[model samples]
Target: MAPVSNNVVGIDDDQRFALMKFRRSVRDVLKPEHNDHFLLRWLRARQWNPEAAEKMLRDSMKWREKWGVDTTLATWTPPSVLEQHFPSGSTGFDKEGSPLIIVPFVGLDVWGLLHSVTRTDIIRLVLVHLENYLTLARKQAQTHGPTALKVTVLFDLEGFSMRQYAWKPAAEMVFTMLQIYEANYPEILKICYIVNAPKVFSLAFNVIKKFMHEYTISKIRIYGSDSKKWQAQVLTMVDKDQLPQHYGGSMVDENGDPRCSSIVKPGGKVPKKYYARNMQNEAKKEYTKVTVKTGDKHCVDLLCADGDSVLRWEFGVEGHDIKFSIKRRDQDGNETVVHEPRKVSEGPPDVGVLSVSGPATYSVIFDNKNSFLRSKKVYYDVIISVPERDLNMSDEPEDLEAASAVAAS
Candidate 1:
């Protein structure tokens, strides 16, 4: 069998030449850290088509400049958002030497916090961690090679609820993170291990799964909701010494109890002391509402002139399934599927961005026509928002204060 290059089966002389040309085109933009391993990720993201990869790389460069990603890496950190809204910790390394983040999901009040603060700030908080994550990952890669240059997320889901799992706003955040992380920060998640998840979690997870690529979905390993069942598996992936004692490891505090004893003591909310002080003054995000009653259909139309143009959308359903489809309609009224029809659910963010090929009316349809007695309603916002179109930073980062807060805490 022939080997695959960027998921493409055949890579001939022309393709190789094209790849070299593409990399050369972005020579000035390449930082010292932008090595073959780094360039290869963008290539794989575009399936090794040099033209597509080149376009992606150009757009990403423009985006990085606009967002001041390097600047953010040097200066930004949202302490209140981290400590109050979403509490998380950077623990020890994984078996591959990648940095590990132990997220005690059972403790977070996902819906409550989304209601309290702007979802935008929540995302910024994640960016703070992502910035730090890369620094740690680079150090790990120095020891274990580039393959170790990713973060492993072990979701401690002991007390996760369907309420938190299926909540629409939280779902929206998940989708937003999925889009941003996948496009801008490709090939970064080494693996995500989820443990002690209840059966009901699957329903919400099925919705969450829609936002993930098959390659990404494959990296996730669920250890069941049973502690005994996952303890062995967790122990195998991480050294017992580094493992949090809550998961049955040797990490202990001064009292000789689990290191995460308070944080992981079943379900609890982040305390008032840590809640964002200026949350009320923060600008909130906006969303468009879409309603679909029984036996009715709705479709959004966009005119795509060229393949260079990107199309993006984000939406959440109100606890019901809506049939979603993206198709291209031609002059003769012939419709061809761009994205196939799937039953869109009430959780996770249903979002996608792709470069369109043919010029025509691209329609995003939501069909509730099949349901006899039930009606579905969804809140959504669609943006044919292309990459790097507007090169501007809209908000100021709380830099020094955030750093001080983290250090002091």
Candidate 2:
């Protein structure tokens, strides 16, 4: 394989100089093994602008420190529910020696899984696995060359259902994962093969792909349930010995099962017994408690100055139910419903994350006007996160603000 560096192929003298400049700008943080290949990723993501790439790199480094990414693989253990039902595994390496990840997409029970664990737990679980795989890729790169520093994924979406994602919380988690990956782990994927896709998958992808970075979107290939077409393509990149028997490869599990359950866990519906609401002492102390009286509403105005910023919220009502929704109010005072109002009960908290297009005010409203007698007590936390690529380290706090209002009837 050819050396993976900016010096190869279509890159010219100007691009090479930009890459060199980016490397020098971040010299204080780069490891001895952090070669031109690694630096090129950030540069390309920032359109070869060394200064923009530098800010992105520094922001990502801070994010890693905040998440403890360097030590997550050593310290974090996924909850039992995720360990058994996460629906993904690193099964083999591609022809270029990049790790091959297999995900039985249909087995993902997002609704059930969230009910069993916190969203933070799910994010940490993904981070831990990513760290583990990247560590393996880096180690392999020493022998297999720099091309091994990424992963190839196969998403088997045979029985995909849009119903689950239609539920707001499930859709939120999906977009959150996509945004987090694109912001911090840019260019980590060599290619993604999404096979056995149903027609409904297109609708879901159209909505969620808006959250993905261009580099990530360009590497994805989607195909229908034609086994002959996809299997042949997969075989060209992965040897039969490395892939599982179920996916047109010769490898099988210890007991001769074709699905290779030993390596790739087949995630299923999480049992209701594992629901977090059933577990005691689940509330965090950080939530702000607010009382919404009958014939009144509580609204939180999150001002977003930039497009592609994320708005996330987690809240729960005590003893009863409250109608929750999100509305976007543009500069002209035109109001549009972002999330339609729905009744949220006193279990597991109504959690959601949105990639909002802004220069608009987003109102997270808890409505109680319909109730003639009951006053709901709501505990909540709402936040706005700007993309790492767009962060201005010295900007004032007013760029993002969350102000609360209690409107009485």
TM-score of each: 0.60, 0.68
Assess each prediction's global lDDT (C-alpha) against the native.
0.67, 0.80
- The best candidate by TM-score is 2
**Candidate 1 displacement at residue 358 in angstroms:** 24
Candidate 2's C-alpha runs over 4 A off are 1-10, 278-409
Model 1 lDDT, full chain set: 0.67
Tell me which residue pairs clash in candidate 2: none
lDDT of 1 by residue, 150-268 (tens): 78888887766654533345655666677667667766777888988775466456545655666678888887767887878777777877777877677775567685654333335
Please write out the lDDT profile of model 2 over residues 255-327, one tens digit for every residue.
7879887788889999998887443444534888899999899999999888767676778999789999999
